[model samples]
Target: MQLTITYFALLRDQRGLDTETIDSPAATPAELYTQLAEQHSFTLPSSALKVAVNDDFAHWTTPLKDGDTIVFIPPVAGG
Candidate 1:
């Protein structure tokens, strides 16, 4: 299926882009992250980030479908 992925914070830096659309065989966020981590050499683990589907916070194991927009939110720190 084709999905849209958005990156933020460290993930954006690592991915070198704010968003991208790609075709993947992943069934869930967890699987997609693992695949992406390996492909992009992302250092942070899935446990260190939060995922959102279609703008709503979602589980890492949330089912994905064609054209779903996914955002992998990295940890943030500020005063």
Candidate 2:
């Protein structure tokens, strides 16, 4: 299935885009992330990334459906 993926902060810089479309064979958020990271060579610790599905925060085991909007946010820091 095809899902829309959005990258924030450091992830966007590394990926060179804020949003993209990804195709995955798995049904959960974690699976999709694994697929994307492998496909794009994005080196990020899974524990350091937050995921949102369809604009709401989602757990790794959250089920994914066609056309779901998924956003990946990396850890943020401030002074």
Candidate 3:
């Protein structure tokens, strides 16, 4: 399946790109992330990241369908 992935804030800096299209056999958010991390040579810390599917916040185990738009938002810090 093919999915569109977006990186925000620090995550975008780590990836060096704002968005990308990924191909994977992964069904859940966690599995897809594992594949993406390996392919992109970046570590994605699940505990510190928030995931969104099709513009809505999603759980780690949320199933991903073809053509889904996924976004990874890293933890934000401010005073």
Candidate 4:
């Protein structure tokens, strides 16, 4: 199945991409992230990030379906 992924902050800089379409067999957000982290060498672990599906906040274990748009939001430090 194919899904769209969006990255933010460090994730975007690390992967050198803000968005991508991926073909994956990952069943949940966590699995999908692990796959991408390995593929892209994303440094921060999922514990330091949040996941969203279809523009709403979602759990890491949220089920993924084809054409789903996923966003992995990393921490943003602000003063």
Best by TM-score: 1
TM-score of each: 0.94, 0.86, 0.85, 0.93
lDDT of 3 by residue, 1-79 (tens): 9999988886677789989887878899888877777766766577878889999999999888999999877777869
Model 2: per-residue lDDT, tens digit, 2-79?
A: 889888887787788988887777798888878778877888978888888999888989989999999877876868
Model 2: per-residue Cα lDDT at residue 13: 79
Q: Output the better candidate (3/4) by TM-score.
A: 4
Decoy 1 TM-score against native: 0.94
Candidate 4 deviant stretches above 4 angstroms: none
Which digits, one per residue and each the tens of the lDDT, describe model 4 over residues 34-58?
A: 9998998988999999899999999
lDDT of each: 0.94, 0.84, 0.84, 0.92
lDDT ranking, best first: 1, 4, 2, 3
RMSD of each: 1.0, 1.5, 1.6, 1.1
TM-score of 3: 0.85
TM-score result, candidate 2 = 0.86
As a whole number from 0 to 100, the lDDT of residue 11 in candidate 1 is 89
Which tens-of-lDDT digit does each residue in 3-74 have in candidate 1?
A: 999998888999999999999999999999999999999999888888999999999888999999999888
Candidate 2 wrong stretches, greater than 4 Å: none
lDDT of 2: 0.84
